[model samples]
Target: MWDNIGSPFDYIAEKYDEDFSNSLAGTLQRNRVWHFLKEEIKAQKPLHVLEINCGTGVDAIWMTEHNCEVWATDVSANMITIAKSKLRDNSAVNCHFSICSFNQLEKRFEGRKFDLIFSNFAGLNCVDENEIRKLNTAFFKLLNENGRLTMVLLGKNCLTERFYFALKNEFKNANRRYSVALAKLTKDVLQPTWYYHSLKLTKLFSSFVLIRKRPIGLFIPPSYLNLWLNKHPVITKLATWLEYTIGSLPIFADNGDHIYLSMSKKITAK
Candidate 1:
């Protein structure tokens, strides 16, 4: 069912960073993710990390620079190619790249276990709940005792998305994330994407304990508003401040354009 996942993402590999990863809005949201990442890495330095759907190896590079060993995987070969190219100059970096998807993690890693498993952006949104159930199983098997899983996924309800689309009178677009929809990867490629709420994920990963949940882009606008945000630096700064101040509140944490969540594997009784 997900055979075309790689093909769609491959089309965006070359310019994905330029378009989203480095954009003003993207930087703001990603910085929040990085903040939480630092907390995770600080707790356990020299971590063994498995990163799934590691587009362009941005996060992997960051982790390796901080003394972590990273095994980064992406389904798109082109994306992996770009990721590998970025690390070619840094031979000392302890990072590896591979072509793999979330569902295929079990077979690929087999007996391997990691101290942390990370997925960024909405990469995990491509699969449905059934696939997520499989991922939960794979995560449980692949992680060491007390290991953490960190993910940043698009949420089912986004205040910014709702307001942005409503101003344009795009009623359907405002609520598009509420159901399964095809997200435009590029002009010609649309891939199936699912928006998951924090509550839903808590139940899905029932075997694990939810340790952290933060709202990304709760006040910062989505990437689509990059042009407008660029023009208004002051508003952008204010939004950033607001997000930093109140994004962690329970009322707002699960309703952003994206959610950053971390869960720890439960130590089961024999």
Candidate 2:
């Protein structure tokens, strides 16, 4: 399954950072994710974190800077290559990069366990329902007692994307996120992707207790629309403020470009 989708990602690996990771909208959305991460893991000492689908290793680098030991893995070898290059300096020994998919976690880690399992952006959205369920079981086995799982996944309904496209009379594009679809990377390459609601994820990982969930791009526009937003800095600033303010409110939290969820493994009684 991974082999079929590897080409599209490998094609995009070199330009992924330039195209989204460092873009204005990507920076804004990721900053929101980082804020929650800092609040969750900052004071924890000697933290060991495992990041799945860690494209280009941006979040892994940030984790290491905050004194956490990080093992970042991605399915695409080219993506892992770019990530490894960014951390090749001897000083970044705390961070490690490998090529592995979400389904390969158990095989890769074996006896290892982490204090946190983190995945940013919409990496996990590439899989279907079954894969997600398997991931829940794998994550439970891979995490230490009371360990946490933090993910930023594409939401089922993105108000900003819907509104943006609807205004342009692109109805199908507006609603494309509501169901499973093929995301086209090149003329011939298409990757299957799924959008998930917060409730669905909570239920899928029911063994873990949900600790936090919030809207990430509710008011802020998606990365594809950043060019239009860049032309209007003041509006972008106000939208970002709104994003941080009302992002966690009910009805608002799950209606964004992506949803951020944090869940902790439940300790079982002996």
Candidate 2 residue-wise lDDT, 203-229, digit = tens? 999779999888899988889887988
> Highest lDDT among the candidates is held by which one?
1
**In model 2, where do residues sit more than 4 Å from their true spots?**
1-7, 88-91
260 Cα displacement, candidate 2 (Å): 0.3
What TM-score does prediction 1 earn?
A: 0.95
Worst 10 residues of 2 by lDDT: 1-10
Clashing pairs in 2: none
Q: Residues 1-270, candidate 1, lDDT per residue (tens digit)? A: 123344688888888899999999999998888987888987546899999999999899999887789999999988988889888566336999999977788999999999999999999899989989989999999999979999999999999889999999999999999899998887789999998999999888877899989888999988989999999999998999998888867577677989889999988899
CA lDDT, every prediction? 0.89, 0.88
List clashing residue pairs in candidate 1.
none
